[model samples]
Target: MTVTIESVITCPSCSHQAAEIMPTDACAYFYECTSCHLLLKPLAGDCCVFCSYGSAKCPPSQEQKGCCA
Candidate 1:
């Protein structure tokens, strides 16, 4: 499978959305909403904020072995 690196994160607080570049080396634990300033964290059981709220999974999560492996 081709690993997707782009993710669209929509802030749950204000419904704002932004396309962000996902890091390939590490998990992004927190993301600040550019529109509302809401700090976003990964949902329960998720590895990173991108995995929780993004349109695509984080790079680490996309690995064949799973996140943070």
Candidate 2:
């Protein structure tokens, strides 16, 4: 499967959305929402903020390779 690098992260607090370029080599452990400026972290069992709040999973997750492996 082709790994996707783009993800849309929606802030839970304000419901604001932003498109982000996912890092291929590392997990993005934290993200700050552009609109609300709320800090976001990965949910339990997820590798990155993208996996937690994004419309698409992070690149590693999409590729089926364990994130940070």
Model 1 residue 48 distance off true place after TM-score fit, in angstroms: 0.3
lDDT of 1 at 13: 97
- Candidate 2 — what's its lDDT? 0.91
lDDT of each: 0.90, 0.91
Q: What tens-digit string does per-residue lDDT give for candidate 1 at 1-69?
A: 788999999999999999999988888999999999999998999989989999999876787557765
- Identify the candidate with maximal lDDT: 2
* Candidate 2, 1-69: lDDT as tens digits: 777788999999999998999999998999999888999999999989999999999887887888987
Question: Which ranges in model 2 have alpha carbons more than 4 Å from their true place?
Answer: none
Error of 2 at 45 (Å): 0.7
Please report, as a residue range, the 10-residue window in candidate 1 with the lowest summed lDDT: 60-69
Q: Best by TM-score, which number?
A: 2
Q: Name every residue pair that clashes in candidate 2.
A: none
